[model samples]
Target chain A: MPTKINIRIVTGVILLTVQVLMVIYARFDEARYFCWAPHDSQNEYAIFATVNDQTLTPDQIQKRYRIKQKGIDPRAIQHIKDIIERYETTYGKDSPAEVIMHYSTNGIEKPSWRWPKT
Target chain B: MSVNPLKIVNNEMEPQLLLTAKAVVLGLICGKYFFKLSDHFLPVWPIFDYLGPPHVFEAVLKVLFIFGCAGILFNCRVRLCCIILGLVFLITPLSSMVSYRNAKVFTGFLLFMIGLHKKGEVPWLVQAQVIILYLGAGINKLFEPDWQTGQYFEHWMHNIIKNPYYINATMLLPPMMLSKIMCWLTIAVEFIFPITLWRRFHVSFFLWTGVLFHGMALILSGDDFGVFSIAVLCSYFSFVKWPELIRVSFNGDNLLHRIAKGIVNVFGFDNHFVWQEQAGGPLVATINSQTHTGTLAFKKMVLYLPIFYLAVAVLISLAPTAALKSKCALLLYVLIFPLPEVIGYLKRKREKA
Candidate 1:
């Protein structure tokens, strides 16, 4: 017969283990977002991929991102901004900083056109 | 001296106890397939990319085919039905692998155990599968960095309370603390799941905690994970001493007690006659009660009656609109099925507390 004490102890340990695993999973593992991108974005679909990439419409981006959007870590947003700035500086192409700024402030907006052909 | 036919027939019911097991296993399998059909093919809302040319026509056809085959087997021999039920264990994991291996593996174990009910033996294969599942999930979670630091829980909670359904003013507390608490709580629950199953710790706390934790996840995220959590609680069935509750139930007020006891006894019951109680006597009694009688009867009825009646009701309700054929029926099935039980469970718990 299973004693209540035994159940309690087992429960405690298992609870701890799950909590720990969840934290580790959230931090280290790549977040799984169900969204659309230009097929090369490693299956990630941010609400605005680099803000002004005309090929990726805001509607498409928002649709993909909106499907599974959760709370974004404040620090994670900074990380995104840092990566974009670095990429723009390295490429030396007149960067879409203003577009990036627009998305960062306004969130994603819907586009008037249909989804890009998959 | 003449032997009473009733007495002889009563004697025969003992050997036929396994029939009950066959019925339950068959019932659950049919229930699941029926449920899937409604959810996948005839949903009220078009799932994701539904209107775009049926993306999973093959998968949909396979389910229909299996549902048809299972229906035939259910009407045939019990022993043969059970063997075929056992074979279903193979198909679940294979199909799951085509989707996501992790989900498949987890689902496979649940299916395997539920299938084991056909013979009334808690096979070693099932026990091992359960242990491996919990251990594997626990280990994987342990190694993840976000999980280790507790940020996952923190992130989850901050967004969780913001969902319109779960919004509460009390959630204005610091996210860091919530995150840490959630992180530890998940690990602690997973680590001890197997231990509690093995009798190293009491399982009720773990099971109840899991219900709360997972319940929170479901409510906040609108995820169906709460169903899986409830199924996991069934794993601790061996440890649940359900008889105490029934015994206590009968102890209050003489008039009520007699009425309850008389009803059970009149039905020619063993321990299995009482809901949620384990049989204390006879191999047949234990197996039969769990499978053929009492709570098992309720379970079987819950699975079969809902699908059968709802199918008829749907057909009638949708007769005017032949185009809606199964779609309208499916909506009614999903919406109405859990109402009584969900309300009952909550009411019972409230009364007890």
Candidate 2:
């Protein structure tokens, strides 16, 4: 018969083996779980808004309205565009969010900040 | 002679040690209720949107999650209740978010795992997971050009923060100098955090440094990071040796003993429960009363640490400095935790002398 310590040891082994296996499986089965090997600080999206040279206060530009997109998704442009328009209409159309932000830690990499021509 | 950490054992205090860990999780979860209620950070996720469980049912799931976690904390079919809690988390919209997934999903899994090990000490797996989190964070930070150079950190502090006292403090030096120092320190501490596993004292030291870093950072700069900091700090509760925990419960003069006595009174049990030891014999707690004269097998699980921890969480919850005070409480234990080892070493020296 297994003693209490033995039972605990077995349980720990089983759980650990299964979790490690899950991480391995995540490599192949993307849907089962997300990436196991975390992306080191690769893609960063900094939140910034400005009028020419003067940066806008974080209060004026709602931090909640800030968009953090993952990877090379083109839809990121649209999201940022929406936030800018929302900020303009609500706060001031004349004081549009001018600066392009480039801060991201959502485990996505290699994205550029490009301004959409108005 | 070097101490072997694995040789340390006190099977009798296993449950309460784990229960204390549960109390931290429960407290953090309860603290999170306000944020969730106000719908502060719930972003619409594309994954949960299409995979369904729709955003509308969040309130119902929150209620279910609270009760489920409460049931688990109370130790009623803990594993089953934890699974119910996990399912709620898995289906929640925010669960798909990277931050939420990293925090809640991993933590829920840990709770379920620890529940399974209730009869034993906190499992080796939970300890490894914490090591992995720090190592992962450190490794992740290492490659970041901004973390290496401190440029991003400076920009973040100077631009992102609104009205934090620490911002002024950081200005005592060149903006880049402080950021650069902090950036590197974070990486170094996290990378080496896993080494604490080799010894008990090392674990406390490592955890204390982490608490100080997080606690001081939060207190000086109100950076909406209290949740993550407290959740991680609670992980250290698992590493607390069972013998020390039992000693705290038995020593009638200490706060833990008084708390234990208070708990006994609440259950209508005699508050005179005392731990008695004899030469070359097992330790035992004697329960002597008018009608009942009994010796508890010192069997740990049939005992508990929930009430003690809940009482602490409640005290912190009521305090105006909940964040800072609770952080101090955790930080205070860092010094307190090493007393047993310090005392033991001195006793051995005295005998040798």
Candidate 3:
């Protein structure tokens, strides 16, 4: 009986600790997985990209990101930034793609992000 | 006679509640997986690049997820199925940052806990996980400047949702004040729920509040969170100590009663209700020595009947408009269903006076 009680207590503690830690981590991390803060931000964003001296259309931008080119992303604006950065640094590396994203977070418009860091 | 929330225990175990929870959670996951399979025929997501060039590991995981869901639903090695499903949810999010949703992770954690649960034991871990979820959500929102200042709600309602009701309200009341009120109400409720849910007396109140809160969210957002609200509501069954027997007596001669009986026979897998003919006034249901008549009795019947509850949830989720959904939910879940009981109580009080 004591062993069972201890096991239960340990399990409970481990489960709760992990959840609490994830919640804390969410504040620092851009990808808020395991965090309960859903819809905390309404990121209205537009993505622009130029690959090999050719400007990509909205359809191309959507295809690249697997998200709509211009729409409200109900997460942190950083999520969009990360996706753009990952794609540019990865499969599109050799192509010399220049990407820019202008976004507003919760009615407050922030500066645009340019790929390759200016 | 008042219905005691606790003390409704069977000698074996409350398999009904557990099974219902499993079905709802797994069913929602299955639906999500179906969409994922259709959307990405091959694992073109960045996370799949690590396993192999061909995406064989991702393919196997998807197949396993399907089998896991089927196993759980068919009652074949439920514990093993839960573990497999839990692992799939845990690993799937790692494939891409975009796929990571708080609801998915929470669902995975829940399945893991469910898998570990022993029969006839109080589900302390499952209950704790729920409390932690609400508490984390509340605390996070409390600290977020956008949430505290009502900016998030303002932007969400005006731009993202384009909710007509909110827009109409903005005409009469100050938009900031209205948004602030909504923001604080949500924060308070989320915080209060975690504290209250642990108590037997408070569980039912918080559960009802949670249903209304999440129901309103689904209406306004239109499945943006994707079964998060439904999963949370279904998880509330974990807290309830469901009655072993629900005796529903109705007139067998009546066509309506016969139809109701037929529905129960078809859907009530656990045989929670004991059907009998009492050719009299309204349909009466006796649960835990407490008798309910009229619409209240019908409400109780539906509450215990998991299939009916799930059907109602799906219908609410599928409603096209926020206005229509809110009106229907308020009428069925809140007003009309309980109005008869309130009137009865008032009449009895007047008679005694």
**Whose TM-score is greatest here?**
3
Residue by residue across A1-118, what tens digits does model 2's lDDT show?
A: 8545666556656755665665555444322232223222223355566765676666644453534432321112333444455445543456555656554432333354543334
Judging by lDDT, tell me the better candidate of 2 and 3. 3
Measured against the true two-chain complex, the DockQ scores of the candidates, in the order shown, are 0.04, 0.12, 0.55
After superposition, the stretches of candidate 1 with alpha carbons farther than 4 Å from their true spots are: A1-118, B1-98, B101-105, B114-120, B160-175, B203-222, B238-253, B258-271, B274-353
Residue-level lDDT tens digits of model 2 in B197-307: 534556656765776766555544443243344456666666655333232124444454445445554542212244433333333343221111112322231233334
Give model 2's share of reference contacts.
0.07
- Where does candidate 3 clash, by residue pair? none
Candidate 3 TM-score for chain A: 0.79
Assess the local accuracy of residue B199 in candidate 2 as a C-alpha lDDT between 0 and 100: 46
Scored by TM against the true chain B, the candidates give 0.49, 0.63, 0.82
Candidate 3 Cα deviation (angstroms), residue B47:
8.9
Q: Which docking band does candidate 1 fall into?
A: incorrect
lDDT of 2: 0.48
